[model samples]
Target: MSETTEKDLYAVLGASPSDPVQELRRRYQQLALQYHPDRLGNECSSEAESGVKKFLEVDAAWRLLSDQSTRRQYDLQRRARELKQDWPVDSTVCLDDMTWDEDDCVYTHSCRCGGRFSITEEELEEETQRKQEDVGEKEKEEEQHREAVVCCDTCSLSVYVIKDVKS
Candidate 1:
């Protein structure tokens, strides 16, 4: 629903992920002014069109990042993207495929890269909470509790395990 569905807001505004709210606002204002269609009214049609598009993108990014709730959601999605990029998920495994370690209280699956993908109960519970908060009630009713991906710490490998419903 947010305009930042595809592009990274921070990148679009030329700000860091950890940038302060004031800094983000300042950057957005500058970019908005630079790319405003009205400011380039006398420019060539092609250039004006490009400027309009960029202006819209900048406005959308600011809209999503300026709101606290939307910003939190965006941050969560961004973090997930970064994690996936770093780990490069290699395979999917069901809960049955994993070996449960009682002492460590985690489910572990072996990775092809000589590492292991593990998920703890706490992580599963946290993920469930996040999902419930993210989706609408109607959507939640239609969706079943799904699997979670766990990444290997030592290598670019990962696995998906059906999160324990009881947890």
Candidate 2:
């Protein structure tokens, strides 16, 4: 739902991240009805096709953002991803130095700036999958090195979450 997200779920629902849950639900309901394929009738028109696509996207976005935990995870990932691209995330650190939060599935390292640098397990898993897809079976014999850049929650400092994955 944040501005940094590649696919802005908020924009899909015509809502913002700051909007209350009730407001989001209301907006979702309105959009659902407006774009419902049934409402568009049985006509095989371009409008109907567009409506169906929008309706599916709206539903998918709501599914991800409706849950409090999922939304938090999404927001965290989006913020970190955007910051990685814009901020000076030149510092590197291994995952062994970070503290793990089991409930949130996040790894955090305390920054000297009185903030925490965090990265989610989901982001790390995705990176692993992407690496697997990019390399051939022969390349899998070698160790995998991955890096996810994350920014401090309280300041502008960023770090590369570098880790080596065994084959």
Candidate 3:
């Protein structure tokens, strides 16, 4: 999920990743008690419904954070996601905007830093294959899409390449 639109489990329980287990448990208990559906009464009021949702979120947060292995995995994945999103994109260029080197089987775009940003046709094909292999049998989704980031050969600048599936 996109970071901006995605919900943060830590924020759900008013806890941080670095917080101690005791602190997390304390925050989780506080939130659980505050949002427990049982305390909201029998009436199907909007507040009660919202409380139920909050309670479920709190419970889920606790489930992931309470386990040592699961917590480590979650932290690693979150860090990778943040690192992926933190990179600065020098520009966004379409695959067609690049010059194709038929001999090298690579597409190249000129960077403002005077370094070349290049991606090979084989690399793109390999990425598509990797994504296809990653699809689960239970997931019947048919759409296939992936991003190809091309970094400058001589500089830290990177270009976001948008490859046209038809191109």
Candidate 4:
């Protein structure tokens, strides 16, 4: 997999997101053993592609969230979400060069070209920041993503170690 969406890894593994590392490891091991290819019958013989795929998915999700480093990152992301939710995202906008029309109770902007625009202050600020980020685009792309072969479609198997996941 080139990228894994920012999912709650613990939830994906069917565990509480705040589960202890040791518990997480134990649960993952149990799931991995249950899903091992050796335990699965021949794919061609059984014709259970979807079944095998689901098993692999459960195994992969468990493996990713069980590890210390990956688990920590997932936890941090979860915390970030909580913090962001608590932040007061004020949506009030400020209008530029517009007198409030009592009839409409909305501010309007008149352009030199005889055009008009209506926007809140927040929208304008957000737009300005987005424009700045675009103008300062990175010169070289960063390969922030790490590849992992989380599943064997032909068989239900997975590896927990980083090296194993990579191959």
Candidate 5:
């Protein structure tokens, strides 16, 4: 019923958007360290509270986006937001993937695509494995080609092209 802006978690954490997972965690730790209330003195209670709030937000965002399933749900939410931005007149599409966990204050997506058209995390992993196997096979073929040289008799020129093309 209500909508919120899909924030860039990296922006929240004040880190580079393109940072790797390790880098992201490191950045979040650094920022969290800076905002930690234990380090704050009595002189700046308001500032400390604000910092803590921001740090919590950053940490929460990072936690959500770091995990595969949660990140996917967030991504879907972000895509929906982008669509809304592009077409202001269009009604909001219900992406009922997220369900709030009361204690954690985080949303857990109930990733049910319905009927036989479901795309589960297991399916994604299988697909990824398939792709990796395909890549490995292609790489092996390339390595074999690299070891063997092809010389053109007409030009007396030898060239090694990794890309197999029908000429």
Candidate 6:
């Protein structure tokens, strides 16, 4: 793949985003050994050159993910990209603009087409649980503040709900 193409770093190291640091390190080492240029020594073929390029990419991914700060930044960027890809580009109402419905326990925002975009409390809670399960306690704490994307019930529009922090 071209360098400009968006690559999932976790995929490069053959690990999941939820994988522990040790597991990530292990996988990186395994991939490095398999793709290292020296490992394919005395070869001047295209395959050998490809292996070296892959090794470099794998090493770069590991370097970013192995560090807690860089990983957090990467996660934020990745999430933003995913949100853009998953939701309607032009329809992004902020949580502050939504009306909170006490009965339904959801934040609702009106779409231009008259459809309402809503996100229920249960949905936010479930998302939090999933994140906690995937990223572990430490990272979960660091990422306590997050935005949830909710779609309009009638139209293809969407909105972002900034969940209230729970005690």
Best-to-worst lDDT order: 2, 1, 6, 3, 5, 4
Overall lDDT per candidate, in order of appearance: 0.79, 0.80, 0.77, 0.50, 0.50, 0.78
Number of the predicted model whose lDDT against the real structure is largest? 2
Misplaced by over 4 Å in model 5 are 1-6, 16-18, 42-44, 86-167
Candidate RMSDs in Å, in order, are 5.1, 9.2, 8.5, 17.9, 22.9, 10.2
- Kindly provide the TM-score of model 6 when superposed on the true structure, using C-alpha atoms: 0.57
- Cα lDDT tens digits, model 2, 39-127, are 99998989899999999889888888889998899878766555445558758889877899888888999998889998887796675
lDDT of 1 at 150: 78
TM per prediction: 0.62, 0.50, 0.51, 0.41, 0.44, 0.57
Q: What 10-residue stretch in candidate 3 is worst by lDDT?
A: 137-146
lDDT of 5 by residue, 26-90 (tens): 87788878876676656566888897777677778778757778767766776645433422211
Worst 10 residues of 4 by lDDT: 158-167
Candidate 5 vs. true structure, TM-score: 0.44
In candidate 4, what are the lDDT values of residues 9-63, reduced to their tens digit? 5665567876786777777677666666766767655545655665677676766
Ranking of candidates on TM-score, top first: 1, 6, 3, 2, 5, 4
lDDT of 1 by residue, 1-167 (tens): 44567778889999987998899999999999999988998878888999999999989889888888988999999887764453455766777768999999988877777788888877866766566666778786765556566779678667666644443
Clash total of candidate 3: 0
Stretches of candidate 4 off by over 4 Å are: 1-3, 45-47, 81-167
Supply candidate 4's per-residue lDDT for 72.
76
Model 2 reaches what TM-score against the true structure? 0.50
Cα error of candidate 6 at position 56, Å = 0.5
Model 6: worst 10 consecutive residues (lDDT sum): 83-92
